[model samples]
Target chain A: MEIIKIGMADLGVAKPPSRLRTTGLGSCVGVVLYDEVHKVAGMAHVMLPESTLAKNGEPTVGKYADTAIPYLIQQMQKEGASIRHMVAKLAGGAQMFAFLGTNDMMRIGPRNVEACKLALKGAQIKIVAEDTGGNCGRTIELDSTNGVLQIRTVNQGVKEV
Target chain B: MANFTKFGDFQFDVLREIGNIGAGHAATALSKLMQKEIDMKVPQVRIIPFDEVADCVGGAENVVVTVFLRVEGDSPGNMFFILDMDSATHLLHQVTGISKTVQEWEEMEVSALHEIGNILTGSYLSSLADFTQLNLQPSVPGLAVDMAGAILSYGLYALGQTGDFALTIDTAFFEGNDQVKGNFFLIPDPDSLPILFRSLGVPFDGDY
Candidate 1:
């Protein structure tokens, strides 16, 4: 398997027979898009919820969910991926800092998950599976061949998304 | 109150020594993990009152990684590893051997970063234990958001009023062409403060 590791604030795309993975998702969001027909997969690890929070207005396609998702879809389309056949799997957005209180402004994890959900919804993509919330951080893996999303959290064994 | 003379100089000195030892071990661990020679400097230590922590650290824009270690019997306090976002990402990439362009802030990635935090904090506390002969055991480290204000707020919330003082140390890590800078914030209760200071050979002046 050609495995590609994605780091924070990075994005990756793969066709059939390729695998994409990202680790350490505390308050950060991971988005996986799979096109069943074309057998192509794309994943993005977004650091912030929105690109507006970015220092400059330059706009990074994979740095935020709002921008990254659309960008991923476009890239996949260029690769002959069909929108109707694409399935979405989301992970991460763990509340690594519970002591900060469960409030909106300070809770980046919940906000990240919310933003991802909203972005996918706006893009008309159905969220086939999701693994989110809680106090522990997570690591996620996406298999482009079978569209399997796997999530692993500390002390909490790996589970399929 | 000793005229507030040299405030916590002695305490700071001892903490710096402890930071040196801890950072040494951390550098070794990091070097092995990154498969490169890492240069580390002795950390600069400071003791700041809780209310003034934000000012001392230059507020929230700076990235910070908060680590919680359990001391005494079941009371887990905090240790913060503060840094800039670019440096944090750079260090993370180096430690994991993952390229920077493939950035994906996923759970495993965060866990990988947490693993580094765990190793660094573990080494730090181990050095403290060896020096002070105190059996202070750290808990399984948990990850907090990477912002100074968020980390400080979380630490304050966890320790409450008991967290009267913070022991901070600034250090730098260099690996060939890449370098990263960071600080460790130790938030301990008043009762524990004296114990920590005394462990570091700081003379107490019988002043609150």
Candidate 2:
């Protein structure tokens, strides 16, 4: 009945009548997993590629692609969504600054996308749609009722996948 | 990760003073460029969660103009000069006399803004180096007109690795009747915190 908002390095799951949303994704991937049969959806705003890259203490499970995808799957399954019935849609992971090429961090956007794809493949979840890898920021929302992902950008307007 | 959460009032005050010196030099440079007087607000030093970082600049999706620089050398961090649409328009008009509505940035406007950012951030860094007596270097400025969330997050990768929270020293300044307003943000990497404090002769709680 309400929208569940996810912040940076966070994830959430919802059932019918509830939607999942994350805004202002730049060089960060927004991964959505949905089960149309169960009307369930889960989303994560992933900031980095791997959890192993963390130099300090343990990071949150939702912050890295290696951990977030599996965690999202497990959360959705608790809501009656099965991995077999679930499909994935992705948005975000855009390089906001083009001239920051010297730093290895500049490759983070594409690396995030690559890592997400690898994680989804490991789970055998087919990516039904994607809007990724550009020089812009995106806000994405997933509708649990019909398994649609809507992406919005500053210059490109809005599109539903 | 840094135990910045354990910081005391004195630590925050020291950070505030750091922002003050850096932004003060930048403001003086800006005043000279425009030949007008400018006033700066007191700097604010905050340690906030990532989700709330964008709220400091309007919001995540708010359209903004930003000039970004990567500070390297003894103290590594990210530097951002953010301006709203009105401020960007006002700036372009003052510097170049191109008074067109700033819906989309032309090549010339982008170049002018980039140069301004280079000059201001250059001065900002040089003055900080003078104060702390540390060797600080800034990368070439990169200009972008985009959503604030997207632009600002680009500066977060280093800090995001260690923890969910970010420490930023921010200063806002006004130009001539407060029509043109901009903010200067210095987000030092987690590893650089101790180096910064040691240079300023402030005691960092090593146990924390």
Candidate 3:
């Protein structure tokens, strides 16, 4: 019953009877990978879509979807969780502002969601559930014991997927 | 990231002056709207890590109202106006004379708050534009009620592309025994720094 907290541009893994949580996902995506058979879960707070977009510094591997997905899987494998039993669930990736412009950066929410999906698909991981692309912010929690992804937002109530 | 860490006290003092002028105008606008005296603190300018941005208002899970705008033009950047739930409600009551009772009433309340944000931030931007002689335009304001971390992170999108740190120019304001309190944050894009300082005729040597 320990709940591990993941900060922005960070990732972590947890076992059964434990949960993985990340808060304040806005224009960012929270991707959860779970191995049902092994009861292992991993969560990542991805700030951007691609690693190539990083410049002037060493980008945090957990900060981009293309890198974070693979890194999370690697960590899960080290925990003895097999890829064959892994399924993905996603939340967050919301557009906190609107009508700014058609600039790709302005549509970061959809871009993050699309990027996460592409990365997950590239890894051959099936996405079982998702909540994305709204104008509000979300905080997500992954319950490893039951593989339930809980999403909370303001105005809208909490929901479990 | 390390570059900003090297900012001297003089540099920070300069940024603080920018915030003071900008927020001072915003305070004037807010006072006119609410017909109440508004007092703004001396602005604080800092270069902070991305993970700590939301801590200025509260923790990541702290629910609050936010109005965000993208600063586009000569010096592109991000801007945010934030308020806690209680302060938001107080402002709504004072401005629109509406009391929240029904769930459906939330939309109207949010709209009213959005206009207030638009007006205040508009004034803040205009004064900055005038003082710096830079062509700055604010995009349409977007409103959301959510965890402070989530809403504030949107302002960091531009900063995240190049570094893990963000240079934040922030100002906090209150009115009448703290019944209404809010914060304004301005984060310029990494590349926009030189443009900003150049427009102001400040000597720039690529160091903070």
Best by DockQ: 2
Q: Please provide TM-scores, in order, for all candidate models, with all chains considered together.
A: 0.51, 0.97, 0.94
DockQ of all candidate complexes = 0.04, 0.83, 0.69
Q: Write the per-residue lDDT of candidate 2 for residues B108-193, one digit (tens) a residue.
A: 88888889989999999999999999999998888878889888998889988888889999999999698789999999988888
The reply for model 2, stretches above 4 Å from the true place, is none
| CAPRI-style class, candidate 1 | incorrect
**Candidate maximizing lDDT:** 2
Model 1, range A4-105, lDDT digits (tens) per residue? 987655688897687898766656678999998899899998756776654323555666778888988998898889999988988867666665544454
TM-score of chain A of each: 0.93, 0.97, 0.97
Task: Order the candidates by DockQ, highest first.
Answer: 2, 3, 1
Error of 2 at B115 (Å): 0.8
Best by TM-score: 2
lDDT of each: 0.66, 0.90, 0.88
The weakest ten consecutive residues by lDDT in model 2 chain A span A98-107
Model 1, runs deviating above 4 Å: A102-105, B1-208
User: In terms of lDDT, which candidate is stronger, 1 or 3?
Assistant: 3
Worst 10 residues of 3 chain A by lDDT: A94-103
lDDT of 1 by residue, B146-194 (tens): 4444345444432222223444555666767755655665554334555
